[model samples]
Target: MDEWLKAGLDYVPRWIDYQVQHFAQPGCAIAVAHQGEVVLEAAFGTADLSTGEALTPRHRFRVASHSKTFTAAGILKLKERGLLRLDDGVGNFVPGLHPDIASVTVQQLLSHSGGLVRDGADAGQFTNHRPFLSTAELKADLVLAPPYGAAERFKYSNHGYGLLGLIIEAVTGEPYTTWIMREIVRAAGLTETAADIGLMTGGTLARGHSTRLPLGRRLVIPGDNLTNDVASATGFVSTAGDLVRFFSQLSPMSEAGLLSPLSRRDMTRGHWPDSESVLDRSYGLGIISGTLKGWDWFGHSGSFPGTLSRTAVFPAQGLAISVLTNAIDGPAQLWVDGIAQILKAFHAGGAPHEEVADWVGRWWMLWGAVDLVPIGGKVFASPTALTPPLAEMSEIQVTGRDAGKVIRASGFFSPGEAVARLRDGRGEVSEIRLGGTRLVSQSAFADELVARYQGFSKDRA
Candidate 1:
């Protein structure tokens, strides 16, 4: 194994130990890949606490919403074949489905900008319990309201995704699930992964168990079958390995043979600004765009009964990570770090070993007022305004590989505040500082003067 892989493997025991201490999770599965090669595929803990079936690399788990990327890719593949345009409005596909939804477009649906309410059914609606609604049925039953506006903004709408799935069925002349299997799944060669909603009732399925009490007394009940039939927006189960394989294609220079270069870029292009200042990180079609650890990555998070999953791919570093837990409340935060650390160790050689002067710069957050500016090649942070006596600093660090660099700093300046860091991607000294007191910092210090003030924008990753 390569040194990075060795390092990643070394951390597994530590991760397992940590999970045991923090969450008491039964078991966890993690997959990490770099430059199209999976260096680490290990499972720690138990797939079933009672049975003591040790989690293994071959184990499968429901990747919940992580299925969104596959479904979105299926829709985009149809677009690639001249079947539909994202700009095509929702009404065009689902004719007369909703009179109020005549103005919503497919792009809006993908980005969750469509003004569809989050849940169509009230709490007591599904009380006694019933079979899940089909895709078209879901669209009709759940889509109760109209778009808030024509402009796209981020508002997670499951109904919007359901509508997207419905459109897929209409355009492909097949059930949404069937079309996805033939076009995206088959094309991607994911034979083992599918929307197996009722796997528990059938053979060759992993039993899903919840960590907490059964909700509505329907615990351990078979998942709704509608989940698979109408999977365009949600509803798909996959293995960590297969998910890593599917998402590996999304990296900028990947060779996964799933998406063409043009298609990959098209999928990543920021279709709509998610918020005010973050131009780089936004939603496009069905994918979320952003940077992590200094690498431009794209993917989504998924959640369902007894499942929570997240998959991310760092394009510049040519790395991807996927984690799936059968438990309802998995170690989500630690899981992300575990994969990040794995990627960092595997691709450590590729990461910048020596700091560069150009790496020092200022960054502005998309939502916060903190500005990270480079001064004298060292790092300094000013909370409200960039002025003198800007507390010298402590524990400064920079992370993220080439093209996606962030500066992090901890201690003193902003007590109780998360260590501040410079945001990634932009060339100038402007960066968005995440996790600190949002005390509206103003850029009053002169740029040149700040540069000579012995403080660069400390990376607070």
Candidate 2:
């Protein structure tokens, strides 16, 4: 890995952990891929708030609308095999659509321009207040008169993708899930990606939690609500690692990518701007394409009942990141965007620019841990707890062997404050005292913990 990328990867976990805790989310899983190499995979917080089961990278999230991306790939694959065409109308294969609705082309459905009702009046399936739509139930809705004009503009319609799923079956003689799992998921080498809720089993499925609503506190959703016939539109479970791995291949021109380059270009190229949206974002064929950090990228977001997920693929950088949250309120989008900004800042100036400062090291105190971090040739004392991840404690200038004095630590210590460093006879740093806390060396951490317990015991009521 390049030095800048390696350093940026190190920052990924710590920063993400800070944000995950800072937002007090139930849990978050993140993964990053650089040129097909999984550079980082991490998880934080509880999978089940009720049981307090800690989450791990293996945990699965209902990557809801990400299913559309897979479905789009399936359509393109069928096209590759001469089984279907993008211009084929929905009525071409699937029987019994309203004449107006049936004539909407395949590309139109993939890009959400088919003018189909999104969920018709009962989207309660998403919240488990009602069951997810059954095939018979979905068919009833599609047969109704078209509500919006075909090929008019972008209007997101999950039910349109559902119709596409039906079309997939009509053309392929195989269920959508079976074909996608074997052809797309397996072919992409994604072991953890599942085609639908029914197949997401035998592993750590993250229990999604509700956002705090007008009723008051957030509650845990069992997260096993079936996606039913809508799996092609909203049902898929995966890990962050698997998500990034899959999306990285969406740049089909990339090495060993699954989709034909022509298909990928058509899918990723923006087809319609999300009206009034300031982000310069547009909807493509099952993909969200836009500019980030001046790089044209394409990816998607999934919003399930109690989960939120976001992904991005920077084809220019050969990089991608996926963030999944078990909580409805999780800032998966913001976190992913922050990561992209961080990478841009690191990579913008060409090389790593300056070397890591000499003073950076781990330290221990009664409160917890603090890290002396070097960024851009300067040191900042970062408290692990009791402060944000990179809160400044003090910047110090070396004064003697294994010793330094405080130059400044905004909001923590005064300028010229003594940052006394005590060392063993071997000239190795043993402990550091600053801001009325003694940070013991790693070797002495056990002793400090013992002393902390003793202090706790003495102060007990």
Candidate 3:
């Protein structure tokens, strides 16, 4: 691995752990893969808050709508075998569909342009109010005329993928889960993934949790419900490690993968713009794609009842990342983006040199914490609250072992100022001074605040 990448990975877990603690999230698991090999797999917080079970990289998450990517790959795999075609009409193999839906092509459903209902009238199945739709229930929803004609616009429909599952069954003469697991899951060299909850045999599945609001406390949600027929759409259970491994193979640059380079290209192409979304995202076959920081990323996000997860593959960087959280309001999206930002910063700054290697720690002030990160040959005073922590950071040029000068910073910050470290009688650095501001370790700062304002509570009362 490049030294810059190593530096970024070294700090990723620390940042993620701080975020989890600061936000009081249930738990999160993250995995990163480069050049088709996993380089980092870490987890923070707890699997079950009630039991205080520690979360680990081995824990599986619902992964939810990420199943769509797997299903899309399965469909393309069938095409490779000459078993079916993407342009085939749905009714060609699976009978008993509404006239309008029957005429929709397979490609339409894969790209979510079939204009089918997102979920049937009652989406309670997603909120745990009812079980996921069975084949009969899903087919009944398709029996009704679609709200829009085929290819009118982009419309996401879980029922559409459910119908694709049925089509897979019809063409292969096997159950959706059985065929996908044997052919796709196992074939992709993923031992830590399952098509549905019922098939999960190894590893602990992290229990989901509700938000700590409206009730003032989080409630444990048993996220083991099986998706009977809609398993292809939202029933995958996987670890972050397995997710990154699978998504890495989806890159067209990958030499070893389940699909041909042609299929991978078509699947990741930006087919339809998500006009209704603010994120400038697109959909292709079954893949969700977007661009960030001038880098094109293609992957899928998933939302189960009390879990939210996201994964992205950057082909140009030969890197894939997966972030899975076990809370309804987890910052998986933000953290994934933040991780990317950190990686980009390190790549831009290069590796830390020995001159400033030890000048690394998170220092606190009255407003917030600042991470004194050593990168390249200098140090950056980066705010902890920002998603991209290193953005607009203050650059420090070390002049001595315990002294530096702020050479670059915002106009409001103390640029062209001398930075110094204060040490105690033991000759250990205990505090830092950035011009007029005093910074200290978190524990020291807390103690100082308590000592200085201990009587304020009583006076206010």
Best by lDDT: 3
lDDT of each: 0.59, 0.82, 0.93
TM-score for every candidate vs. truth? 0.68, 0.82, 0.98
User: Which segments of model 3 are wrong by more than 4 Å?
Assistant: 458-461
Please give the distance, in angstroms, between residue 218's alpha carbon in candidate 1 and its true position after superposition.
14
| CA displacement after TM-score superposition, residue 286 of candidate 3 (Å) | 1.4
Cα deviation at 194, candidate 3, in Å, is 0.7
lDDT of 3 by residue, 23-51 (tens): 88999999999988999999999999889
Instruction: State how far residue 219 of model 3 sits from its true place (Å).
Output: 0.8
Q: What TM-score, to 2 decimals, does candidate 1 have?
A: 0.68
Q: Enumerate clash totals for all models, in the order shown.
A: 30, 0, 0
Give one digit per residue, the lDDT tens place, for model 2 in 1-461.
Answer: 88767766776677778677767888999999998778999999999999999999998999999999999999899899999888988899988888988899999999998888989778888768898888888988889876788888889998998888888888878888888898888999988889787897567899999887875777998888778778899999999999999888888557865988888889999998998777789999999989874877799999998899999999989999999999888888788877776676456533232443455567886566676655554445666543223435566655654555667767545567666667789987777777467888656887767766878887894
The TM-score-based order of candidates, best leading, equals 3, 2, 1
Weakest lDDT window of 10 consecutive positions for candidate 3: 383-392
lDDT agreement of model 3 with the native = 0.93
lDDT of 1 by residue, 321-408 (tens): 8777666677654466555653453354332223523443333332222323233233334331211112233223444322322244
Show model 2 residue runs off by greater than 4 Å.
213-216, 349-355, 359-461
